[model samples]
Target: MITIERVSQVPEDFLVDNPEGGAFYRAYGRAGIPDFELGCFIVKRASRPVTTAPFFIMKLPLNTMMPPGFLKTLLGRIALRVAFVGHPSADVGRIQGEQSAEVLELINSELRKLAPLVSYKGFDGSLGLAKFNKVIGLPVPVLNLPPDYWNRLKHKVRTDLKRKLKASAGLRLLETDGLPKEHLQRVYELYRQTCDNADIQFEQLNVAYFRESAPLSKYVLYFEGDLLIGFHQLLCSKQIMYCKYIGMDYGKSRQYKLYFALMLQAINICIRDGIRQIDFGVTSYAFKRHVGSEMHQTFNYFQHRNAWVNALLKRLSFLLEPDESELR
Candidate 1:
């Protein structure tokens, strides 16, 4: 018989298979993000552990992709109490078990007890394992570069990248295994500012997470003369560089095209390290595409405990999809 249990936390050995996502669960755990109540689900088959997944309870906005107006604002304020099936602490949701379809459906049946809305996020779009309610996710962008990358790109592409780099010519670069303690507060402030200015909002990371997660991340720091202007966090695998998060002083971002310069810098870093691909994660569609990054499709599976609402969501799922242009 299969059984499921919900716990406030997991043992240290949970999800040990993917060590490459260093400090991920530690930094983005139960107490990591604001307004998130992380739920750890332990699924056992015949009393043997099969999967340990992180879920969350939060208020999810109903009005996405709507124009900025009274209708949007009114609907935005009206959120649903949602129970998410994957790790809600990060941009993508991951549930590790390597479970078969039958096991996944069993797990799903158990999780539906949590709230009106239950969704599994950050899975590859190709994995249509279950025929549950499906929402197409924002495309994940990545840059695949080879040796002599600059020379291989079209002439116009090279010229544009060069111009962007020239704006930040005076800035100095510092690459470190982790952020120094002395610079934590400033970097955290920049992170907050970036989140505040963003057009879409999700779970917000706290400074506590940044401080604790500092040691496991690879940082690319930007210094404008003596002043620090920006920094980006990366988690690297053998051949792929996951550009996870970034922080920047927006006051100087336009002055030096800081974000663009940072991407150029990341490209250089990837080339130097022989990292073949740069996974820029999601969002910032225009700039990502301009840099020759291709979008990889992902999906979120959801359902509502109420039969009527579940049917309603299926009908209105179109409102939750990414624009066709963003898919490019």
Candidate 2:
């Protein structure tokens, strides 16, 4: 028999011991994602030791109008399908041994007790997680740097980077663990602008998220004179430097080619530090591809406690999902 335990907080040692939990969970408790509760699910099987999975539980509303009598009962069933559970961030999920199927079954069983629907996000496609749930592919671009990485870049990319570097001479790059409140506020604004301009929207970071996550991250801030023009948040763990977040002044970004400059800076940092790979995150596929980044497919799995609803979701998922062609 498998028993699952939910806890509001996880022990520090648990994170230290489980490298499979990945780096995002290392500081997730303090990241302050809105409308989500940070917690871990412990899976215990009879005499065997326990396994833990960290996740963000998102409580969703059943019905805003509190349906009357029979209507309430009917809509409540549908509402149960509204609740969601997912990884705290990109590329994090773990289940031990041959128990991936069992763990997922147990999780879905547990979620049904609270809500009708639940989804696990950001599992690598290579895991074969699709066997038990409807899986969708979300490909992310990554750059694997070989020695002399700079010379491998396309001619156009190299020329563009040099031009941008020369044009950005007035800018000073500063790495810091914290930013002033005003600077933080400007960064937030640039982040918001970047999100607003995106073809597909995802999480929008708040100031608290940045302030709290700063300790685990290296903030590469580009300052033009006294003004903050752009910044890149690089999450460092082991030999991988993930380009987790970025923000820039839209108007000046185009004029001075701030994006190219920032990307080049990130590459230079990785080369100097001997980082193996850079997870460039999603979107901006063309530019990342031109600069030698390869595509790795990520997966999201969904299931509903109600078999009928689960079947319907599996069929209609394509309509609601993004077009893979967009990545090209």
Best by lDDT: 1
TM-score of model 1 vs. true structure: 0.90
TM-score of each: 0.90, 0.82
lDDT of 2 by residue, 1-328 (tens): 8788876655455645333234446456666777666666678789464666665666433432232356436745443333334454555455433346667667666766765666666666554344336455557788988768878777887887687777777788887755555677888888888877665544456777777666667777888888898998887655677787789898888877788778778888888878878888776787788888888776667677668877886775663344655566
Candidate 1 lDDT score relative to the true structure: 0.76
Residue lDDT tens for model 1, 203-321: 68888877777666788889988778898888765587778778899999989888888778888888998989888878888888887888777788787878899899899887667
Candidate number with greatest TM-score: 1
Candidates in order have lDDT scores of 0.76, 0.67
Per-candidate alpha-carbon RMSD to the true structure: 2.4, 6.5
